[model samples]
Target: MKYRSESILLLACAALASACGGPDGDNSEAPSPEAAEQDAAGPASNDMPDTAPAETGEASGDHEEADDDHAHEAAEGGRLESHEHGHAMLAVTLQDSMLSVSFEAPLSSLGAPEDPQNAEDEARIEAMLEDFRNDETIISLQGDAGCEIVSTSTGTRLVSGHGEMQLDYDFDCENAGGLEGVRFGGFDQYPALLSIEAVFVSDTQQMATELSAASPELKIQ
Candidate 1:
């Protein structure tokens, strides 16, 4: 069952750059048939655990505050760059009812084609992009947090033929004040995704944590 789930995720992320032997040799895209099936199975929420809220202490306060400042500075100015293939970075900023999350990963990790020449290849690439921005399933909130995506902006930045893409997702959670836990839904949709170095900033809290396939939850106090 675990293997099955990961397989579904592999299809969901569409990282099969070497297997996409569709018409015209489109190796950097997901096969249409499997992608359609995966789309059908998605949109169903999972039962992820809600961890206890983050802990704060007198000794950790000053250090956590410093880290929080650095996190916000990084997110606001620009994204965190990563050259590693399997590792990605995520930054989340929460203020009042508005929450912003950013996902940055190597384009090669998704098996990006140098350029699409035909309609078929374009469609396949679009499908892969849509899967990457799975929206509701990309990141989820625990309990009745009422976190819903309000806007999304995606783009690619290339430097010397190597590029990375980032997704900026904005959300409005009605119960924003009760923010406690977050789940990286992309984990269940991308098997190749190893770990995400996540930094979160909130009005009264700031924290950094590493999220892995073995543990994909983030506690936001």
Candidate 2:
């Protein structure tokens, strides 16, 4: 009887050991193919560096374009509008021998010059106009020949002439008093009343003509 009990105890121990070591005993599942693949692919937190110079170049180009557009809009009075081409309007009326001159630029049509040199040129022209307005000689001409600036703005100038002959210049006519007309002597001659118009396009001769016309006989000293 002692030998039989010992045998039964050994058998029970063997069965418990087999059950613990069985394939389905632990209740754990094997890794799926997809999970294995993701592990092999590396961690989700890693970021790779960009390798293409072309992509960098494209990004730079886009930035430059945006900057250019911004500059153009800013220079163009804060908006984009269609420009009128090739014509300045001026209104000329004769009251006496003295000629009153009024002038203006088409702000809507005036574009920001693309080249820096060209921009400087435009600025010089603008300065010349301002100088003319403040010139004692030019003012004297209006008194002698009879003309004066009554009012002025970026887009317009009003002048009244009074001398031997009263001449009024209301240069608000189309294609008669623009930058082009102010720079070129295309419309500098007008009988008893001096109807002068100049266009501002590369030539300085218009400035000379304008000074001469302003005071027909004033010396440029």
Candidate 3:
């Protein structure tokens, strides 16, 4: 009778262990072979490397439409070019507290600069940039508004294809609310810059002024 009871107890314990088994008696679930194989065959992910951004000389402001569709070829005020090298184009636009001034000029008009292939030619360009950087007179704004140049973007290079050179200048101004006038001092620095066709637009007025060596200042109302 004692042997019989011991055998019964052992059988009951085996039955309880089998009933409590939760798929291999472990808490973690095992992955199916099909799911594992699919994960193994998943697509490879390649990380892209960082690259330098392309240069674009876009300024913030509304582009003034050409006064005439054929204005480019037409000369105004007896000048040889209505839109060509010997002259520079200046545009100043104001929106809210932000002020921006954009300047464009022909490379040849800077002087008889040689093609910038050698060190000496490069130095000449560098000198001009230094002058512009130091000149507070280049674009004088009404001082009452406390306007100041915060950032300047300028680029100059020779183009072999058209034998044309270009200089682009963009200045971001802070505290430009009281801006009332501007004076282009390029003529004072580069004698070749005879005149600047300027378009000034602000909250109160839209004006077109031609600044020259003779009359280099525009007073904004």
Q: Score each candidate by Cα lDDT.
A: 0.51, 0.24, 0.46
> What's the TM-score of each model vs. the native?
0.56, 0.21, 0.54
The reply for model 1, stretches above 4 Å from the true place, is 1-81, 111-124
User: Per TM-score, what order, best first?
Assistant: 1, 3, 2
lDDT tens string, model 3, 104-184?
555555663535656786677556655554565665665466554454555553332111223233334455655667667
| Stretches of candidate 3 exceeding 4 Å from the true structure | 1-83, 112-114, 160-177
Candidate with more favorable, higher TM-score: 2 or 3: 3
lDDT of 2 by residue, 136-216 (tens): 332222112222333332312111110011112222222222222112121232222232222111111111222224433
Local error of candidate 1 at 42, Å?
43
* Full ranking by lDDT: 1, 3, 2
- As for candidate 3, its clashing pairs are none
Query: What is the Cα-based TM-score of model 2?
Result: 0.21
Give the winner by TM-score: 1 or 3.
1
Instruction: State the lDDT of candidate 1 residue by residue for 1-221, as single tens digits.
Output: 01122222233234223322445655454645244333434555120000111211111000011133554544322222224566666666677787766566655455554244467745654555666544445566656667766666665554433345566666788888777767776665566767776766654455567788788877775
